[model samples]
Target: MKNYFLLLICMILLSCKKENKKNFDESIAAKLYNKAKVFRNSNVSDSAFIYYNLAKNAYLERKDSLGVGKSLVNMAILQHNKQDYYGSIETSLEANNFLRKIDDSTTRSTLASSFNNMGICSSYLYEFENSILFYNQALKYVNIPSNKYLYYNNLGDVLITLGKYPEAQKNLSIALQTKDSLKYATFINNMARAKYYENPNYNPLPEFYKALKIRQDNNDLQGQNSSYATLSIYFFDKDKIKALDYAKKMLEVAVKNNSKEDQLQALQKIINLDKENYLENFKKFQALNDSIQIARSKAKNQFAVVRYDVEKIQREKAEKEIEGLQKNFGIGILLIILIGGLFLYRKRKKRLEQEKELEVKNTQLKMSKKVHDVVANGIYQVMTKIENQEHFNKDEALDELEFVYEKSRDISYEKTDNQGEEKDFSEKISETVSSFKNDEVNTYLAGNDSGTWKHLSTKNKEEVYQIIRELLVNMKKHSKATIVSFRFERENDLIRIFYTDNGIGISGDVIYKNGLSSTVSRIETINGEIIFDTKIEKGLKITISFPAS
Candidate 1:
């Protein structure tokens, strides 16, 4: 009884210790997260990103997926604000892996925020399609009316940029339902702009002025800058004088708000409009643009370095934990290595045997193909000539049979050298076509001279010879034609062969079977294209073209 009580006490102590560690880790994660929020609110983006990344690691250690997701979302937003758009997108995607796809409000809100940040980053990067997709995803997860309005506004703006005026107006109309005065102002301005884009004569100046007025009343300098920029663009072609005034106003608001990107934009408009001080404004634009690029590059590098440092620390901690187990597991690891080596050796031996078997099968297939081409096709050609001709020449038939016998013998020796056979390829093609001619079918050949076969390689000539033979055989069997013509021509670097027969055309789908399948494979091997045109109602036309080289 005493021993049982002692064991129970030990178990209780161990459980409490684990519980304490969990609480401790969770507290650290919460504190780090709160610190990040404080830094972000104070506009110290770098510090906020670092703390959020750290909080993410802490939450990961505690296996708190929600905390990790929230931290990553904040980090992604910080990256976005710093113009590290690609990095922001990557972080936002990582956050999505941790976030739950559930109806829980917090998870849904975080998921929406992550997607919304990705949309904004993609828009900045000029990936309008991806931006639209992300914004739609944000809308899917977002239940809050204000966020929905914001997403719709963003989607509408992107749609307008894409020249989708109707879609822009549709989304903007949805956004216009918002009671928030600032959001309403944004929606109306966008809606007006969409109308103007759809019809250039449509005046959006009144809505632009109204949005500017609301921004001014609310002390929203950023919003006012946007309004001024739009108005400047609206009057840019119509009235340079009015456009110059709006551009100057935009510059003033941008400078007051200390927004370098906005300042650069306003300077560009002013440089184009205010010609009197083009050089001065151009110089300012160049300097500010350079400074912004440099700052953004540094911020991107800083975020990367911070993330790397956190990961490095985590890796070092894991390595230390692993080090203590290595000595104890040394014998077991050695045994596993020995067993694994034997298994791999056996697997490799089996793989080699399988490869040998496959090679043998492939060789058999090649020999079978040689037999079909040299023996079977040769006899069929002879039979076709005997069937077509009234005065069958015994001497010519004997010579053809001897050639087939020799070719069949060469297949056993795997002799692929066809230089002798392909030397007179043009004559061979003429004879093959002539042999197919009979009382029912009239065969004619054009451009089948030796000069036409001069540029083709021996292998290519052989393949072409076989292809013509296969087509003639197929025509003899299937195409009960009265006339067949083969036209061969060389144009530039290409050799083209056109075969036409006034036969009942191949009906339905032309399944590549018999020797037709091998014909295609042979053509492909020579980088050739053979198109069998079965669309003709009365006859069949086959066009074959390939490179002369």
Candidate 2:
């Protein structure tokens, strides 16, 4: 009997756990979205916006991109209705990021709706060009004919505002083909306005009256306000009395519809046309305009607050979940940390030993480079002169040998030898290249002026000198050419050196070896590039370029 009681308790506990898991079921997001629709239909815009935002987050948590796009579209529409045009555009753009261009009808519809809302918001903000582009995009995604007509009408309206009357008429004509009577009225009214704007002599009153009659029959207060405003504007210059009467009718309709913006518009026209009550109408206009501004500001703030609150709740919920996970895995995490700590200690010890070995190797390489540059290359330059020049001065060669001796000695003491800095760098470069010239090789020099090396630093000059010397040495050893040319020029902030030799050009890849690697390294230290032209059939051409400073 006791065993049976324990089994019953276990079964009850399992059932409760299963019930709790149902709270996060995917259907919850759909329910929230439907609830938001109900609120929106009931005219509770703030509540609707909040619920749509919530639904978006729930869909995001489920990784449902399409659902998130749909929710954001509704949120944007709510913002648009609240006169938050900028915020509505931003939400619509974000919704577009989540929507895909697929064959799914629902996804395509949601995408189309998002773009259409953006177009409407852009129109409200007076960004007519951007509004046209967004409307065209909406048309591309709109599978339903009614939606296509709506986008076409919107595009035509903006095009008319931009004075593209012919284009506007084309789009409006397409929209007028729709079977929907209300849409036809909107399209025809827009087409008439386009024609009148294009040709001031065109009479749009007939079409305007027809649209007004249809809107009145349908009891569309918003459409009636549009028609009344249009009629008032049409009669304003022609007959002030008729314009005033129509403006008065517009104000009545706007007030009945509770649209502050339309009321403000009508009041402005009345103040302009009705001289008998100018001050009275002006006061009403100012008060209505102020109230509309305040309401729009408050709506923008409320939307921000709703989004902030939702994000805050989500963040706090995430933090709590993290905290619970941390608690649940506390011991496991502690053990992992202990193992990681031991592993890091061993790894750090090995890294330190490796770093020390690398430091020693780097020191050896530095000394080897100094020897090669100061001693070996110095001797090679002297040898080349001795072998090439008919009148090689013994005293000058001895002096060069003595300078190399001093530089070599300084390497052990780690002292810099500034002997190369005693002469103008251009003269030094000319003398160095000339030393490599003899009866066998004819060397030509151009653009090696003093101003070419004026802005070069002492270290950079040294690197350039060494690189030129290395190239000449490589030429002497490898290329059996007779003619060699060294051209130096300063173009803007860059110093370029072009070397050519009429010798057996390097075939295939120019292998970097036999001091050539060090030449490349020295060029890199001064932020320079060297290109060896192996494509030449008869001669070698090397170009070197580096910043002058």
Location of the lowest summed lDDT over 10 successive residues in candidate 1: 9-18
| lDDT of candidate 2 over 81-162, digit per residue (tens) | 9888888999998988989734588999889999999999887655666898899899999999999988999999888776
lDDT of each: 0.77, 0.76
Question: How many clashing pairs per prediction, in order?
Answer: 0, 0
* Residue-level lDDT for 434 in candidate 2: 61
Could you tell me the TM-score of candidate 2?
0.57
Residue 145 lDDT (model 2): 91
TM-score of each: 0.56, 0.57
User: Model 2 off-target regions past 4 Å?
Assistant: 1-23, 101-103, 330-549
